[model samples]
Target: MASERIDLLIIGAGPAGMSAAVEARRHGLEVLVLDEQPSPGGQIYRNIRESDPQRLAILGDDYSAGRRLADEFIASGARYVPGAAVWQVGEQCQVHYLLEGRSVVVQARRLLIATGAFERPMPIPGWTLPGVMSAGAGQILLKSAALLPAGPVVLAGCGPLLYLLAVQYLKAGIQLSALVDTAEHRDILQAWRHIPKALLGWRDLLKGLSLLAKLRLAKLPHYRGARALRIEGAECAEAFCFSSGGKVHRLPTNLVLLHQGVVPNTQISWSLRMRHQWSDAQLCWRADRDQWGETSLAGVFIAGDGGAIGGALAAREQGRLVALAVASQLQRLDGARRDHLAREPQGALARCLAARPLIDALYRPQAENRIPHNEVIVCRCEEVTAGQVRADVRFGCLGPSQAKTFNRCGMGPCQGRLCGLSVTEVIAEQRQVSPSVVGYYRVRPPLKPITLAQLASQSNHDLSPETP
Candidate 1:
């Protein structure tokens, strides 16, 4: 098929994407949503439609809330395509994607990228080994397949997901060997500074406290202030090692789940040549946008964790807020009507965003952990090591773009998705500069990998001109 066109095209079906679609439908705007997942929910609420009842009960209310939003999105009548891998996004809202071995293109007046986020880069010794996986990856397995690790499991790292997964494992009646937290004592102390403002979103704070209470009641061998982690194994993970409170501890375990938190998935935004700024507190690059989520590119907007690391609640609110902007831009909603509709969601978004500073402060990954040891692999795609990148820096490769030429750090199948932030941090540390000065990788399309056949299959003709 040749390129298709629509009024509004959305690039994810997570909370943000779904919420935007639902609002766009009410305004009667022609819309389409594309997602890589086999189903509607993004990773956070994956497989909610087909989730087992037992598993749903085990996963808790946050997981269950997605089903209602997804149902509303389905009923809203916006066209939805699942299992679609978006590869390139071009001028005037032209998006190229691959679906089931076929390349497709669509043009729209506006594009909303709700690509969401991924687990923060957690590179350490033996991380590539089997049985050493991210806490988010483990949660997906449990969510999608009800699978749990066979042998004793050790949970390491900080953030709500780590504790949430730990709580879920306990609910599933799985025994854990230990829980090693990388959050330093000073993090908790610094986090207190935000507590006054964080109380504005008291429910979220209470939720974190509740997760902590559950983990404590389970009496798991909890190690606070843990650092210097090393995963040891011959062919697979066998033991987890870290230092805690001036003592070194090693626990025998088969599965080692690691997590630090999450950061925006910025491949699409960066490829669009949108401006980004370093978020000091969140410790990552975020898209520069206006009040209504519009990026530096006029018609392209970003919401959800893709724009910044606000959780699902914030994503949903921001989605609605963006849809209002789109509706007004399309002249489907008059100014008064748009303002009336946006009022509640705008406040909701602010409240949801209020807790982020405290959360980020409480769970910020240590600088040492962020860069890792010189020997540790930095780029999983090209197997580029921290040492190689530092060597590149020593040789006058001052930025990630230059370092990429020297070490091929970000030039791989994943296209710097997994290693961009880590590489930036490593380069900055070596050069004795701030990450903001070092800058992120320069991403280009095809944003994802596509075969030559897929490229050849794309239509030669241009998409129709934008609606005037």
Candidate 2:
């Protein structure tokens, strides 16, 4: 097998990875970045294009920086390998990536994982219909591709993201039938306690308020304390059934945008045998990392949402932090330089933690019996169900771990993130243990789908039959 060594191999090309790649290259390191998408901006900073020069002009220079940075890095000899899906990371810093359907392996002196995040699937009845997607999906359509649905869409979820997406839809000449906020009032009130720590700036809060006003001024129906009852559709989403303010009702809309916040992307970190833990704040497993983005293992680091959910600005700072640490490891910088890079990241992380989202993460739409009684699938990859797991419990399965063994309920491609919390209910009910006790079962590696070729490459290492 051939080998290529880069000083830094960033597994993602999002805001965090982009920043790290730029910083590492500036500090005289050979940097390579790969992304699943065509562009470099992660979820938060959607890579802007000149598809519509007017739209580009409207988005302003602030949003246009991603393209500039991506271009500059590419021009500066930073290899930006887009549309490559990184499948695995080995203990020896070997990365298996499948690009254009061919598996390749490369070793990195140091690895910085900034794999970013994905929307937490908060399942209710009929979420599997054709028109249903995450709020982030809707935002990506407008912000990245300038696409919009052809029918009246319903935006349902909490947090600033919901509103931000709704406004984007409205801006793109699409109309939202209604905007539903499932965030609890007490939770929002309780989040106020963290305001002192979050006093760095009110810009985040102001952005939230701006999005809210944009949705309201667009004359869309807005609902707080709302809940989705069910979505009715056969081939596509015909309409949505939900409740709000103690009133059960049905709203007719062709599309439903769903979100329950986000969880970090720890698939690479986990597959590399890095240590991780459940973040009650985000309600998903996140890689454990230090202030400098160093993971449990040496010569490997985690930055951005792959470690925690601090959004785009925080991710940029984290990328710099990781770059500084990687620079130190390469003997190009000192301890003071590393600390200087981290000062901003730490402050940003503290602010995001003290923001309203932490309080919102306390209740993430999954509890025992919270599964709606209807046609939506929880584990989309497996097509399992609440009824199926409930039946497994009825047939004498002890807990979620056992239920997984018995019925493959939580053993899908997502590794139970989508349905684990839901399955915990059945486990606790059947085993009579605390839901937290049945908390997650043992989490394993390759959390996402990987190719056989990629796995084989790592396991097939041969060192030339030495001494023969």
Candidate 3:
């Protein structure tokens, strides 16, 4: 019922949002941050302050880095609203959200979205089975609850996260049946061209290599050049099968963990109707933005994986840059002052992203791997199959939006978050055009679901004398 206004409103309190708040507070900006999680740290560094000592050591320094940022943000005196689910972000900077089943509205002079990223679509037969989950989902379980999958877990897919999860499993003394890596020999061969540049991030490369080395030394089963992966079971995932090194192999397992990579969580950005472009390397749509994370909208900005797939280091640096830009725009900081403050963080962001091209090339998923087979489910929310999507395409649906009209591929509760990319790829393949031309869904708010009762309550509250 009460509408609060602030100089700056940031959605998400992850690395980018926290860092931005800290820097912006230094400039004396009245800043507020809204985060959906019960605590700070987002996904990458979830539960840092409360993590068990033994678990912290097992998770390693990459995660530990978040503790400093979180602590600084907490002490920075910025107002933070945790466990608030943002529903609508209007173009004019009107923010509508739900907190504890109560509707809250806030208007701000400027807004920043740092919602971060989610696991890429990795659809295959029987993926909707109960025992099958994304690697990120499994990682969340570990990070939030200190939980690990039961033995004979089959991790099928390839990416840095896959290896990271494997290392965590090892550290937790969890057993794995095998790692079915889809990175083929040709991808590594192609990645060699970028090795010189990749060396700039030698620390990351070494860390990655060390994880693999540990996996090898552990004598854990690993399969390379894996393809045609699918899960099988009547009710839940009972086994996994894939082709590796020209041989078809199947493993009896109850848990099938999958990871391809991550793409920016673009739901809010898309709902805001920001300009977006498809990235060939990461195989996703990225919101168009300037170096300071300003989107096409006048006073709206995006930082972190919400804008693109840069990791935490880039996100933190970018957040600082955005804070400076926002301050400058508000005339709190002069243009020259903004430029001077931005210099170091800009360089840091560049260095952090130097090896991204090589890493992206090395793990770029295969084209077939992206577009699901006809029988495979594309939209889990609607239970829409790839075949259904292709059929819609053949019936003159040229893009995800058009396909959604004929088939409810993106109309479910997820609002196309999980199925948007797959739907685009399928439409493009069927239309014999590029995915870029096929375009993505026209995302609208509410970004997350809310009850009609809440809407009615908001309306009634707005008309009441208590509202200001």
* Inter-residue clash pairs, candidate 2: 229-242
lDDT of 3 at 168: 84
Off by over 4 Å in 1: 1-5, 459-468
What is the C-alpha lDDT profile of model 3 across 267-304, one tens digit per residue? 98888878999998889999999888999998999999
Question: How accurate locally, in lDDT, is each candidate?
Answer: 0.90, 0.71, 0.87
| C-alpha root-mean-square deviation, candidate 1 | 3.0
Clashes of 3: 0
Candidate 2 Cα RMSD (Å): 4.9
Error of 3 at 468 (Å): 24
In angstroms, the error of model 1 at 307 is 0.6
- Residue-wise C-alpha lDDT for candidate 1, range 1-468, written one tens digit per residue: 333446789999999999999998989887889999999989998999999889998899999999999999988878888998999998589888898787887778899999999998888888988999999999999988889877799999999999999999999899999989988779989999998889988989999999999999999889998988999999999999999989999899879999999999999988888889999899999999897899999999999999999999999998998999999999999999999999999999889988889999999998777898999998998999999999999889989999999989989898888889999999999999999999988899888788999888875323444332
Candidate 3 or 2, higher lDDT: 3
Q: Write the per-residue lDDT of candidate 2 for residues 1-468, one digit (tens) a residue.
A: 333447888888777898888888878887778788877677666665333665554444446666775665556566777787776678767776766666666777888888898877677877777888888887677677667778888887766667666766676677678887776676667667656655554676666667667776888888777755577889988887777788887788878998767778665775665677755556566777887888899889888888888777778778887888998889888888767766776777666555546335433454411454434466666888777777777798766678788778767776876776667655565567666566554556454466676566553222232231
Candidate 1 to truth, TM: 0.97
Evaluated at residue 362, the lDDT of candidate 2 is 32
Q: What TM value does model 2 have? A: 0.86
